[model samples]
Each structure stands twice: as structure tokens, then as C-alpha cells.
Target: MPTTTQLVISGQSKPGVMAQVASVLASAGVNIKAFSAPEVTGTGKLRLLVADLEGARAALRGAKIRFAEETALVLSLENKPGALNEVADLLTQARINIKCGYCTPSREGKRAIVVLTVSNTEKALSVLRDQSLDEF
Candidate 1:
């Protein structure tokens, strides 16, 4: 697990918007580690965790895309029932607040990459240490 930057982009919820963002990053050789795009009322809020933060930023800037950045905690958890529950319980016990989260699993579904923005990231990481809920 590690701390990384997450880019949040808000844009019109229409066809080709996703393609436009993905293409810019792809052209810059930035790999999307985890991504979520949920649209509401014709607007989409996209969150992305990419391998190359600087490259992603550059690409988005070159494309004139407006985005905001945040510090996020990244975790690798087992891909199975109750996996998230364990983490949530641990955090709850530690009194750490989870602001928002998203996850993606491996191709074979063996493990998941969880991205979280928490109320106290430092405490969250420390509290998570030595917990079985996290694989890394």
C-alpha cells in the first residue's frame, strides 16, 4: 500500500468524453491503475489513479482538461467476500473516516486495488499496518 495522487475531473456526461481523457493519457504512456466515472444529472465526475502522475497531469494540461488533485491511500486487498468489510471494520475501530473510495480487481479477480481518500490518511495508514485486511 502507498499514498498516491488522484485526479478528479468533472465534465459533461456525454459520449466520447471518456475516450477523450483516456486517449490523452494513453498517448502520454500513462497507465490507469484504477478509474471511476459516475455521471449524475448530465455531469460526470471521474476519478483516476494512474501510474505516472506527472505524465497524466501534463497530458491533461495539453488537452486543456480541467482537473483537481487529491492525496489518496492505495491498498491491495484480497478479492473475495468480506474483504472490504474487514478493512472497513478495522478503520472503524481505529476511528478513521473514509471520505470516498473505489476499487478494481485483478483480471483473474485474485486481488483488488482500492483507492481511498480518508479524513486522516496518516492515521489510516498507521492503523491499517499489520492488519490482515490489507495484502500489502
Candidate 2:
């Protein structure tokens, strides 16, 4: 099963803030698993997936950065065409609305890891799990 890990970078509300943050991660060779910017003002939030979450967090803090954290659902599905359509169909049928989602392929497989940010997390998890096709 895949697990979603959220890294909350201090708000980068100002333009160019995200670039600075991304530069730091890029310099560290951290692969971004998933990314999101909160709509809050002043402080910006960035959620990332790195090869090493602890190490990344430590590095950021060593640089005197602030961040928050959370666990999300990360699932991998077939990369073939229409794969997403199937998932969407299922969710729609279940009356689940996906607020946001991002996808990236695994380095070693023909599967894409999708991080879904939804309102009804627990219910979504249940539905996905019941389908025997998702891992969170």
C-alpha cells in the first residue's frame, strides 16, 4: 500500500516564494511526490513527497524553515489510457467529489501514483478500499 505524506512548508504567499522553496528541495535532490499550495494569504503551504521525508524536514529546519505535516492517501493505478476515467467513474458513482488530485509515474512501473485531496477522506478511503483497487 502507498501512503501519502504531507510536508507543510511555511506559507510562500509572495510571488517567487515557491521558487525559492523548490530550489532548496531541488538542490537536495528530493523528488517531489505531491505538491499543493494552500489558498491562505501571507503564509504559503507546500506539501511534497521526497525520497526521504525525515531528512528533507531536517534539512529544511536546519536552514531555519517552518513547516506542518499530515498523512494523505497515495494510490497507484494503471497508467494505461482511461485508467483515470475508471477511477473517476467509480468515485462519481459513490457520490464522492474529488476536490483535488495530482499524478506522477513511479520510476519503476507503468503505474501512476495519484494523490487525492478530498473532503470526505474516511468515506473515500472506505469506498476505494472496498473496490480493492486503491491503496491509501
Candidate 3:
């Protein structure tokens, strides 16, 4: 799987703020895979996982949404039960801790896509892949 970094933006915590930001990404044909609003004081923070980071950033800027960039590990995992636990264990054994993680299954039950913010994703991927487990 191809890995890409996501951009996070912050702005006033008000209605329509998220909507407008989403609208820009939608208009740009950038699929939003994952998103969230982790609060920073009274303002809201927008986290976006998109296919076209540059295009999404441009659109957000055009829409006047203050934003910043950060790196994240994006991966697909088995959709069955215990799959998540196995992945976490593999990372733990390798000493590559997970900073944060989120997952959503596709329409079918074949796979669950997971995005992980980890201390060392490169090492984690290497370890998991050696075990024939999915990490990317």
C-alpha cells in the first residue's frame, strides 16, 4: 500500500467551520479517508486523511482554513476479530509503540483499513511484515 502524510488544521470552534473545510476537500475531488477534531483550547483542530495532500491543502488555503502538516502511517489490516490485537502486539514486541490508531472496514469483510501514528512505523512495518501480518 502507498503511504501518505496528512494535514491538520485549526480554527475557531464554531458551526460551519468543519463543513466549510470538508466542502473544499470535496470540491477538489480529494477523498477524505479519515477525519477528526481534537480540541486545542477553545478552537477546533481538523485532521484529514486525503489522497491528494497538496490539492487538499490548496483548497483549504483557498477557503482560508489555517492548517499544518504531519506524517502518519497508513495501512490495511485483516478485518477479522483479533486482527487489531495482533497488529498491536507485533508493534509492541518490536518496541515500536503506537501513538494513535484508527480503523474502518471497507464494505466487504475482507479488510480493515487502519491509520497509525507510531513512534517508529518503519520498524513496525518491517517487524509485522516479517511475521506475515499487515502493517501497510
Clashing pairs in 3: none
Question: How would you encode candidate 3's per-residue C-alpha lDDT over 88-120 as one tens digit per residue?
Answer: 888888888787667788678688888777787
CA shift of 104, model 2, Å: 1.8
| Model 2 spans > 4 angstroms off | 13-15, 26-31, 34-45
User: lDDT at 29 for candidate 1?
Assistant: 100
Number of colliding residue pairs in each model: 0, 3, 0
**TM-scores for every predicted model:** 0.85, 0.68, 0.80
Which window of 10 residues has the lowest lDDT sum in candidate 2? 1-10
Model 2, range 1-136, lDDT digits (tens) per residue? 4556677676648888777777777777676656877677766567777777877787777666788776666878887899888877877888888876778888887888887766666777777778887543
Q: Which wins on lDDT, candidate 1 or candidate 3?
A: 1
Global lDDT for candidate 1? 0.87
Query: Per-residue lDDT of 1-136 in model 1, one digit per residue for the tens?
Result: 6888899999888888889999999999999888878656787789999899999999999999999998999888888899889889988998888988988887888988788888888888888886644456
RMSD, every candidate, angstroms: 2.0, 3.6, 2.5
Model 3 misplacement above 4 A: 11-13, 38-44, 134-136
Q: Please list the C-alpha lDDT of all candidates, in the order they appear.
A: 0.87, 0.73, 0.77
Model 1 clashing-pair count: 0
